[model samples]
Each structure stands twice: as structure tokens, then as C-alpha cells.
Target: MLRIRPRALPVPATVLAWPVAVGSLALAVAALVLHASTVGGLRDTTNLHLADLWLSVLGPTVGAAVVARDRRTGLVLLGTAPIAVGAVAGAYAVWSAEVGGAPGAAAAAWLATWTWVPFFLPALLLPVVLRSGAAARLGAPVAGVLVLIAVFSAFAPGPAGPFAAVPNPLGLAWAPWLGPAAGVLIGLTAVVLVPAAALLAVVRWRRASGDDRWQLGLLAAGEAVFVAAHLSPVTAQPLSDVLVAVGLTALLGSVALGVHLRSVTAGLRRERELLATARETERLRLHRDLHDGVGPELAGLALQLGAVASRTGEPVLRELEGRLREVVGEVRRVVDDLRPAGLDASGLAGALRERARAFSAGDLTCAVEADVPDGLPPAVEVAAFRIAAEALTNAARHAGASTCTVRLGTEPGSLLVEVADDGSGIRADAGPGVGLASMRRRAEELGGTLRVGAGPGGGTVVRAVLPVPR
Candidate 1:
């Protein structure tokens, strides 16, 4: 059954991201139209303008979706930077287009800012995503260089600077040489960092498994197509725009697919666990019913047969009574095998202690030291007890052990049971038999593990670790 819990509304990243992208695209198209109308025709609009508009819309959409899906702090910071830059630049473009400024200067500034700035955020983040720590180390210096470039561009004086499109937009024209010098630095930094990020992504792709590889491959392909569209000669503007749009759509689609796959995988895993738990619960209930119902019936029958044997001294009756008593014992044993009574009565510790006592016989000393907390789930307790009993039995009978120890304790989020014997170590040819296999199965049924091997003191050790369900 699917359970839905009431929670506060999810952050609106997914909801906001796509609409923002579409709106940005519409605004960009509007800006282009305005420019075309003002300047007289579509022929006046540059391919660079089209490329910038697409990039500005595409970058933030991808970023927002990624940040929402991953929810990583680093990704959030990285994704937000591009969106912030784009928003400001987009607003400026609208203002410049509608209000009309130093003819084409403002439009050029908007195009340049959007074209260069939007891609930089994704490029910077790519390295971090690819090779987490190594990327961080490498990216720090690259980031510092980029920051230096920004500082230089902002403070640079004249229109010939790196940020020439929006020259002195920040009113840094007080220093002319600063802009040109920073622009050079920015170009050089991009040349180095962009290739490095791409290389890191390639390395990541080589190492990535399953869904991750697909996601990375799709992102790479989309980015490559988008970049190629911009670089290719602009023979047909409409065709170019269509191609760029297709590339961006592909990239966004991949992100969505990845998110969907992750959610489906998680849901499937939860369902499997729930199904397993249900099966176990039903098994335990059946065992409990058999123990509670049939066990007492057989015991009562044995008692009545004994009373009959005393009353009537017939040979057949006596013989039948003996056989019936054996059958009763066998029935009880079967019930205990299915689910230990001690486990039901007093939890794991009591169960282990009782088992240890039962296994203790002449020439074999069995000691149980258990500090397990009370009220563990019935399944866990039962499995742990069974495993421990089997281990102790093996140590006492097969191991030729004089001294056997059963220890029960708790580890973080789990219960630990270990049965060790100081005896002749496991024989090489003495393969795992039904008893050992049974113990292992019991442990595994409860999503736990069992290990049987030579102990530290040159004897056998049987250890089972069972998870404690909350």
C-alpha cells in the first residue's frame, strides 16, 4: 500500500524553473522583434543575438532543475549564480529595447552579457559534479581567476575592454586600462578552465554507471550541439534557432528522465522491502498459531494416553502410549523449530540464555553473555535466537569444543550475536551443512548477515548481525 504523509509544500524549483525558462525565451524573442522592427527588418538581427537569447534561457532552466533534483548546496550556489546574472541582464535588455538608448549599444551589451555569462556558471559547476573533491581543488584557482577577470572587467574604463558590450555598465570607466586588461585575463582564463572542465566531465563519464552515464552523455551531447550551432556559419537564422531549441530541449528532457528514474527506483526498493516484511509477518503468525493451537492439543493427548495406560494395563495400550509420547515431543520440537517460545516470552536475551543452557552438556561448557535491550521486533528476536541456537548446537556437537560462549549485544542500528568455541577449527572438507545454512537463511530473512569462520583463538566463530527495525 502506498502511504502518503502530510508534509510542507516542496520548494518550487521544478514549478518555477520551466516557466521561467519559457518566459525568458519569450522575452528574448520579443526583444529580438523589437530590435528588428526598430532597425527596419529581420536582416538587421545578428546570429550572435539569437545564440545569446537561447543560452540565457537554457542555462537557468537546466540549472534550476538540477539543483531541485540533487538538492546539493554546491549545485544550488552554482545554479543560482547564472540565473541571477541572466535575470539582471534580461531586465536590462527589456529596458534598452523598449526605452531605446544609444542606438544598438544597449542591445549589444545585453547580447554579450547573456552569451558569455550564462554558460560560465554551468561550465564552472561541471568540474565539481564530475570529480567532487579533485574538482573543488582545481576549481578554486579557476574561480579565483574568474573573479579577478570580473573585478577587472567591472573596473575597466573604455569600450574596447573584455566587457566591451556593456562597457562601463557598472560605471568603472574611471579606469580605462582596467577593462582591456581584465578582458584579456578573462579570455585566457576561459581558454584554460573550459577545456579542464570538459576533460573532467569526460573522465566522469568514463567512470559513471547506469543512469549517471546516460545523464552525463545527454548533457554533453546537448551542450556540444548548442555550441556547434553558435559556431557554425549562419546561413539560415530560422533553422539555426530551431536546432538550438532542439538541443536545449534534449538537455532538459534528459534531466527530467534522470529525476523520474531515480524516483521510480526508490519506490520499487521501498515496495520490495514492504513485501518482504509482510511475508515475514505472515510466516510468524502461522507459526504462532500452530504453536498455540496444535502444541497444547498434542500435549493433552499424551496426558490422556498416560492416564489410560495407568487405568488399563494392556500391552498394546502401553506401547501406543509410549509412541504417542514420542510423537508429542516431536510435535513440540517442530513448533519450537518454527518459532522459539523463549523468543516470544522474554525477547532475544532470554531466548539466547535458554538456548545456551540447553546446549550445555557433559564435557561442553556453554556460557551466554547478552546485554541486548528489550522489545526488539519479534522477527529480529526470533531470527537472532534461531541463529544463536544453531551456532551453539554446532559448536557443542561438531566442533569438539569444551568451552563455548554465546554473546549478544547491539551495534549501531543492529543487534549482534556471536557463538564461539575453543575447539578444533573447522575442517577444510567439512563444508557448510543444513544447520549452518538454516542459520544463515534465518539471518538473511530479516535482512541481516551470518558469518562462520575460524575464531581469533583458533576455533570456530558464528556471528549474525540483524537489523533492528524502528
Candidate 2:
């Protein structure tokens, strides 16, 4: 069953990203063309000609970066939509202004003023995505986007910047009451989103390692430099633009690196899963061979030995038969260890419930709440089951808890397993034992995580987040 496998994307990244990229390239090419045709390209690249350069490659590249990754498809689309829109609007602004009396020039000019908005908004989600692959919610981020649009819609700035000495076509001509709302937006952005983004970046930085660490770190770093350069002296436009260009290039490069790394990691994970599946298949085959092929033969040998022993009263034949019985017991043990008890009859959730039932007693009570779907990858299922079992065992025997709850659920691209017990909490100074270590190993082996610590108020909590193979 392909339940956990992601449906194929209707459009490939190369197909979508390339055309958009080419369009952005056309923007830069157009900016240069219009620049050479007139004087505004180099004289005022930042506002007139240079605005198109920002969108030249960076905007589309940023959009492409998010598009190439399969995770959070809708959010990625929503987050990146502004890039192309801003680019085209900026390009149109340049083209119209060059033609002197070109239609819609005023509107395009006003729209171009906010070309920097799209690049700023995705900052809200970038840190969160780096920390956790999933975006927790869309409400706040969407609201932020709307607020940005509303600010531009409601407030008409004086004749400056992209307005090009002309009134803004989008903003209301004059509205005294709109300032409070705009003030509120600015304050929230500065106080809430900025600090929150910084905090998330720090948290994500601390959590990520190896390629992940550097990739997201480079993104943060590159964007910081770009922002700093944007705020630099206007007199240093040439130097500032260079810094901005480098920073933007770095941003695109980092995302590309991340996508490449994710592809490689996913491929390796699939290979490992295939190998594990093959190994399990072999285990089952060996179990069958021993059960069907060797069992009868061993029984026949025992029967002959017993008959000879009975006829001649030979002690050696009796001893040989006893040894054969021990070998049979060992084989059965191996077969049993190959799979969890009742795992075949009952799925992961059912096995969890049975394990929960086994742990329940007068002194300790166990409960299970599960929401796992069918057709989960076998490796993911086995890992979840084992992690849950170990957690349950710890709760039952070690925690001395009155109540232990096992919760199994699914997150966007992963399985969530949590075991919380209301016994004495894990000691602050105590190190992780073999059980904890084993659970961590299992989760990490599947490209996930396990967290064991004191529960809220009291007792121990075991949390494992395991990636389900797509």
C-alpha cells in the first residue's frame, strides 16, 4: 500500500523554476535594455533600473528554492508567489517610466515601491521551517502578509522613491486614520516577528548539525547581510548593491545546497529501508525454513532416537534426543525475537494497545490513544512499536507511576510517539540508561528524534518523532 508515500507533484521543480527564472532573467535584461535606451538604468538602478536587478535572479531563485522542496507545498507556493508578482511589477514600472507617457506607468511605479516586501515576509516562516520541517500554522503568517498589503493599499507616501514624484496609484490619496494601523503593523513586525524570527533561528541553529546547520545558517547570514546593505548609505549604492547581490546569491545557493542534501539523504534513507526490508524478508524466510523444513526432520530424528533408546535402553540416544529439544527451543526463541509478539495479527496501534494492556496493573495503569493510518512503512511501524514498548516498560517497572499514557499520532512527514507517566520525574542529574539510548538510536536511525525527560508537573515523558518513508 502507498498510503504514506507522497503523491507526485503535477509540476516538476525544473519545469516551473526554470521558466520563472528565465522570466526574472528577462527582467534584468529588460532593465539593462531600458537603461541603455534611456539614462535611468545606471543613474537610479536602486529605485528605477536597479530595482529590476534585485528581481533579476534572486527573487525567482528564492521562489525556486522553496518550490523544489516537496515539503509544505501550499505554504511554499503562497510564500513565494509575491516574488514573481513583485518582479513583473518592478519590470513594468521600469518599462513604463522609460516610455514617458506609457499607460499604467503611475500604478506600476507605486507597485514597484513595495518590491522589497515579498523578500521580507518569508523571513517569518524561514526560521520556523528550519527549526521544524513543518510550518506549525498559517494563520499568523497569512495575517502578516495581508497586513503588508493593507499598509501599501491604505497609505500613500509623498512624491519620493518608487513613486517617482507622482502620487501612489494603489494607496489612498490621504487618510489620517490609517497611520495607527500602519503604526500597529510596524510595531508588531519589530517587536513580535523580528524577535520571534531571531529566537527561532537561534533554536534551529542549536538543534541542526552538519549540512543542515550550515545551510540554514548561511540563509540567515546571507539575508542579514542583504538587509544590512539595503539599510546602508544611499551614497554607497554601488557597494551596497554588490553586497546585496552577493547576499541574495548566497541565499539561493544555500537553498539549492539544502535541496541537494535532502535529495541525497532521502535516497540513502530509501536504500537503507530497502535493505532493512530485504533483511526482514530473509528473516521470515529463515523462520519458515526452520519451522517447515528442519522441525519435522528434528522430530523424526528424535522419534528414531527415542525408539532406539526404548528398545535398547540406551542412555546416549536419550541424551541426544534431549539436546535436540534444546536446539528446537533456541530456534523458536530466534523466530520469536525476529518480530514483536502479535505484531502480525495486530497492526502497530493494536500491538501498542496490547502492550499497554500488559503494563496495566493495580499499582500501574496503562492507556493508549492512537491515530496512526494503515499502510505505514514497515520500518517506521516497527520502530514506533519498539519505542512505544520500551517506553511502556519503563513506565510500568521503573517509573512506579499510577498512570501511564501512550499516544501515537502522525505529523506532516513523520510519526509521533509520546509516552508520559505520572510517577516521580526523571532525576535531573541522572544519565540516559540503555532503554533511553536504544529508543534514541531507533528514532535517529530512521532520520527522526527521541526526547526523554521530566514530564510536566511530575513523572517521565518519552517522546519519539520518526520519519515515515514516502
Candidate 3:
């Protein structure tokens, strides 16, 4: 399989992340302070105070969490918008409420006009949640339009009672033209932009999988609550405030939880990969120990037995010598069974050729065609050699074959080994034996496949493909 590397974050940007996060968090805390002060200290019973505080806290917390994990600039900016805007607006509102001069009047008017800004938080994040460049492209213009509406509504000459159901502190009046224009713009945004964003989110949710699907579903639920509260009659009072709190909480909580879950899944996958690597290393170490240490000792003992047999010619001694020779052969076979020693000396192609030569005997003509490259990974080489050995053994011992062919080759990203025997094919009622299963397991462990069936030449064919690790 081809592997694509992700782009790395630049060094300076990564180093600066913590400072930016702290700054954003500080701004969110400042917003909370202003909210508490304006609502008559910490003892305020108003629902607006509670809603504003919830938003102020949730904004920075969710932003920091997303930035720390994903490090996507777009998402980070979206996540922090609520905290920044709320901080500025809350500070202005608190100053306006405390002082009663000209500056205070202007600040109060601005606060009353732009009270809807906090409600725009989810809409601002719609682009990020939708995960589409086109949505992001369109979001910029839609956001600009919303801003224009806010500016017009704030300065418009009309008797203002409240903005977005929150009581207006400054009974400021607006111009006739400004009020109608702002009202028309707000209506257009609600009619066009909101549905567009919702449709985009739905489409993205349908296309997403795994954790993304869950995240989007939770986000949708939160958005539904937010919208329902905003569209409800003005008499809903505390109910609307409660809905806003629940919706914002659900949105931020879902994002944080999604990020946490994705991180956990990635960590578990890495652990599994590390364990597999350790097992492969240990298997290769045992192979080397047996081949280097035990094989030589057995060979030396065989030679000593040969020398003793030449000097002593008794019948019993000769029989014992014969048995000793058989034992030596069995030891050599056991060493080979533990690991293919030929793989160390030669690569996969050379090792397969050696196995093919060993299998060729009376009534069996084995031909090997190998075109594999050097420097394949050790695991791939071992799996290919073992699979070829097993297939060749089955062909020679079980199949009444006249001729056999072993071919080794490479594709773009994998090594292929095929052992085909021209003999009576496998019986229909025969069960798959351990040797065939072992071959299949080896191939699968290496992220490849092995197929056993009738060959094109009317014989049993066993083909194994092992991926070449990048």
C-alpha cells in the first residue's frame, strides 16, 4: 500500500501555541468578570447572566482543547470567536451600566444593538463543522452580512425595547432607513444562510464515518436546540435562556469528546503496531540463535560419530551409528523448520530457489523463476519464504505431480510467490489442513493474501502475495 505523509506544523507556530491559548483563555475569563459585574456581582438571579457565563467559559475551553489536538488554524479561530467577541461586548456593557455620561450612553447603545452576536457563535462554526472549502468560502460573505446587520441595527433610529429577546438597557432610538434595512437583512440571513448551513452540515454528516459521524450528530442536536430557542416567542423568558445554555454546552462538549476519542483510538493502534514489531524481532532472534549456535554443535557430533564408526565394526555399533546419523538429519531438519537459514545468506528470491531445488526429486521436476529485488523487509522476506516452502511441500508430498513450477516476482508495492503443481487437483470433499491455514495466516499477518485453488494447467496452485513495507 502507498503511504502518504501529512504536512508538519512549522516549529515557530507550534512553539507559540501555548501563549496564544493562554491569551484566549484570559480574554474569556475577562468576559465572565464583566458579565458578573454588570449583572450585580455574583448574586445575580437573571438568566442572561448565567447564559453569558456559560458561553464565556465554554468558548475558550473548547477552543483550547481543539487547538491543542487538531492544530487547525481555521477551527481554532472559529472556536475562539465567542470568547473574543463576548469579552469586548461584555466589557462595554459593564462600563455603560456603571457610568452615566456620554461615553456610557454610546457603550450602552452598542451593547443593546449587538446583543445578538453571542447567538451567532454556532453559525460562525458552521463552516468548520461542515468540513467543506466551499462552505468556508461562502461563510466569509455571510458573516460580513451579519456584521452589517448588527452595525445598522445598533445605530438605526428607532425606539428599541430589546435585542434578540434580551431587555435593552439603553432606550436608544434608530433612523427610519436603518431599522428597515437592518430588519430586511436579518430576515434574509435567517431565510437563506441558516438553511444553507444546515443543509451543508447534513451532507457532511452523511458522508462522514466513525467518530466524525457521532460528532456531527451531536453538533446537529445542539444546533437544533439553539435554533428552537432563538425562534421561540419572546414570552418564553427563562426557558429560552435555559435552552441556550443546554445547546451551547452540548456543542462544545461534543467537540471535546470527539477529539478525545480520536486521540485514544490512535494511541491504541500505535500500541498494537509496537507489539507486533516486538514479536517479529523476538522470532528473528530465536531463529538466529538456533542456526548459529545449535546447528554447528550437531554437525560436530555427527562428524565424531562417523570417526567412531570407522574404528568399531561390531553389528550393534554399526546399527547405533546408523541411528545417530538419522538423528543428525532430524536435527538439521528441525533447525530448518525453526527458520529458513537460506534467507540470511541470500534474499527472498535466492531462498525460494534453494527450497525449489530441495523439493525436486524422483518423479518431480521443479522449475523456479524468480525476479525479485533486494532489500525487502525482513518480515516480508520470511513470510514469503515460509509460504513458498509450505506450498512446495504440499505439492510434492500430497499431489501426485509430474512437474511443478515456482515463480517469485514483484508488483508495484508487493512481492508475489506462486507454487503450481501439475497433478491431480485437490479433492472436493477434502478439508483445509493446518499447513494451508498456516500459509494463509502468514500472508494475512504481513497485510497480504494467499489463494489456493486449481491452476490454469489443471493442478493445485498456491499463490501468496506479501506487501513490501514502505
Per-prediction TM-score, please? 0.56, 0.70, 0.52
Q: Candidate 1: where is the Cα deviation over 4 Å?
A: 1-15, 31-70, 73-157, 160-166, 171-255, 313-374, 378-470
lDDT of 1: 0.62
Q: Give the TM-score of candidate 3.
A: 0.52
lDDT of 3 by residue, 250-337 (tens): 6566656666776686577546545555666677776777667776776677677777777876667667767877876776777666
- By TM-score, how accurate is candidate 1? 0.56
lDDT of 2 by residue, 306-336 (tens): 8888999888888998998788778777766
lDDT of 2: 0.65
The segments of candidate 3 whose C-alpha lies over 4 angstroms from its true place after superposition are 1-53, 73-78, 81-84, 87-99, 102-235, 303-307, 310-470
Q: In candidate 1, which residue pairs get closer than 3 Å at backbone N, Cα or C atoms, i.e. clash?
A: 156-179, 157-175, 157-176
Best by TM-score: 2
Candidate 1 local lDDT, 1-470, one digit each (tens): 99999998876666666666666566566655544544422223222344446556665555555555564422422343343334334444444544556365554443334334434545545535532545556656665766676566444554422333344444454566775676677666555565555566666666665445665665465445544553456648677666655654554455445555665755665565466577657767877777787767877887888788888877888888789878878877877666777777767787677777777757888998988887777677767777887778778777789999989889889999898899898899987799988997777666567778898879999988887877
Candidate 1, residue 263: CA error in Å? 0.9
After superposing candidate 2 on the true structure, give the runs of residues whose Cα lies further than 4 Å from its correct spot: 1-14, 40-46, 49-52, 71-121, 124-236, 341-385, 392-418, 421-432, 444-448, 465-470
* Clash pairs, model 3 backbone: 156-174, 156-175, 157-174, 157-175, 158-173, 158-174
